[model samples]
Target: MSPPSGATTTFLLIEHRREIADLNERIRNRRLQVLSLYGTPIVVVLTLLVWAGLKIFIWLSSDTPTAINAIFFSVAVLLAVAAGAQFYAEFTATVWKDAETPVRELRLELSLADERHILEARRHTPPPTDRQASYKERLPQELVRLRIESRHYRRMHLMMQWLLFVSSAAISAVTAWYDPPQPAKGVLIGLGFTITVITAAAGYFKPRERAFNLQQTADSIEQHATALELGISPYNASEEKQNLELFATTVEGMRAEQRMREQQLDQPQQGQQQVI
Candidate 1:
């Protein structure tokens, strides 16, 4: 029998989809920005390179020549590096767009729990049309599984990170080798190297950090959902508070497995846990 009306069940949830109407609030996949950034520098570098090559060709035919090729090499390397870095930033932002799914899944779990609580509180609503009640009952478990799946976003995140890396390495090597910056142009060459190094490092590591964070968050949320699906609500306790322990593990650290242990201790091992 249902509890006498208004006994709400709340499940923490993450929504898997983003549907915010405001464009500003929307998350963009990091890929688009990265393409632009990478592509732009490539374009700029190529133009300068071609022009420089033309100048070199012209110099060869002339009776006398100036140090035009040196200037061209100096400028081209700097521009290519700048573009690569810019693209890297954009690529990571694109990765962040994928973060929305984990957030969304968490939201969904919470929303489902809220529905469960509401249903418990209600007294005499007609049975949900057809299998709707059964469907609702199954939702909690499904939600947990869905959330667990979201944890892999980090894997995808890393893939994109590597993509940027390989591309950057190839580009940088080619730029350096194809047109070695001359020592007489030491100042310019040094500046170009410095910028390229800095940008490459940032682009490579920043998104990996974010991917880690997102995975951690997803794991925590999924664990919480699992406990709730089995009828263990941390909302009430002699269970004793642990200072948002779940959040700490999944959000800031790799504690999904630890969370599972904590939640299991909160629940029972003797009986088969209910699913659906």
Candidate 2:
């Protein structure tokens, strides 16, 4: 039987395939960078801040008063703050970037392609439009909007980073103006310790929270994908495989999250039952 002539199904398939291919390639190539740039520097800056704070605390807590104590203390505090700010900014940018829209939408496109391929494979009468669509496709238009939202969030993250950087730097500068590691290293040692604790706390929490969010989002996506597949023909081999892959990825993540949550719930419950 002849296929739909004016429907442009082939073109749709080709276009979507190319797009998914491009996105997958680009995403794969840049995955390392995205992971690295999004949050790694925060760790380094945090470490420095911690060490600096510890040094500052030791200096301030000591009874052996060095004449340069004030100056050293101030310098350590300022530098630690600056490091923290820079790390926070970078992390903010990273989270938004990781959470952006391409991840979901590209998979949806693959699903559309698969639907087309499936119709072709059925070897039945080809109609004007391919009616066999998987439930996996949530909505292309909505997905596009989500991608936009993701980028917008990324911009916000960038702004946050800058805010952190400038604010921390400014604080550091203020401390520096008051005192520097001028005449004696002992002056800054105690101040370093104090600054480290504070800076480390801020830096770690800022990005760690974002990581937690990503893990949470990943779990949500997994649930949606599973629900989608449950309503569809999973054995439809003629369809694109990418959607399956995406679903599989999310499913694994969800399973892990479920296990963790279950463990948390049972831990407390088990303790109570034991007491009873």
Candidate 3:
């Protein structure tokens, strides 16, 4: 039996690949959401808030006799919150499983296409419509992807910085108006703890640095791509293929450098840990 046409096979490959990627991304995001919901820092903050709120309520009501009951009540509320978090995590896991099923099906479908046939079809296929897609065809896609990631990191950095500022100001204000044995003290403690967490997160993650590195890499790739298109500088080659090859090489090098930067950012203390 003869193999299918090159165009049909290519279309099938591209369509199924895209769907699988999307499904995997969805599953990954759901897992991250569940993990964040029950993260240690989040749990600690919630616990502190509950304790503070309960203590304040007891003090305000002047029900000194029921202070023991308030303690038990706070315990009950924390238990209930834990149960809710467990249920949400389970629900998220179920959603992730559902998303994964489609991905498995898609992979199985692709596996049914004979590898030899797919490769042969691709070989006979004409070049893609995009002229710059001659080699390292994914460079443009990766550039756009990096730009999106850069923007996401930038937004996170901005939000975290604002959180730090607002939380610090709140703590200072509460301290200035401090009165011992008052409910405001509880509020001040909660604010102080939150600010400490935020500061630690900002220092550890360094989102601003990540955003800057990503944006710089994206910009460099874009500059090279634009130069290649316009036949300028080092990209001004007599042969278009040479220019494209150069563009692909330079873009790939930039991407590799960006990946290295990310690894360094993620594991800055790795060497210290190893030494210890």
Among these predicted structures, which one has the highest TM-score? 3
- Candidate 1's TM-score: 0.25
> What is the TM-score ranking, best to worst?
3, 1, 2
For 1-276, candidate 2 gives per-residue lDDT tens digits of 766753565665556677657666656644544454455556556756665675678755655355455655555666556555544544555533433444456556557666765665454444422332332353334344434544554555565566556655655665676665354344344445545654654453343334344445544654465555564544344544544555555545655664554344334456636644
- Please state the error at residue 127 of candidate 2 in Å: 18
Candidate 2 overall Cα lDDT vs. reference? 0.52
**Per-model lDDT:** 0.48, 0.52, 0.70
In model 2, where do residues sit more than 4 Å from their true spots?
A: 1-137, 177-276
Model 1, residue 133: C-alpha shift (Å): 15
Per-residue accuracy of model 1 over 160-212 as CA lDDT, tens digit each: 55655665565566567655646425545654565566565555444444444
Q: In what order do the candidates fall by lDDT, top score first?
A: 3, 2, 1
For all predicted structures, in order, the TM-scores are 0.25, 0.23, 0.60
Alpha-carbon runs more than 4 Å astray in model 1: 1-164, 167-205, 232-276
lDDT of 3: 0.70
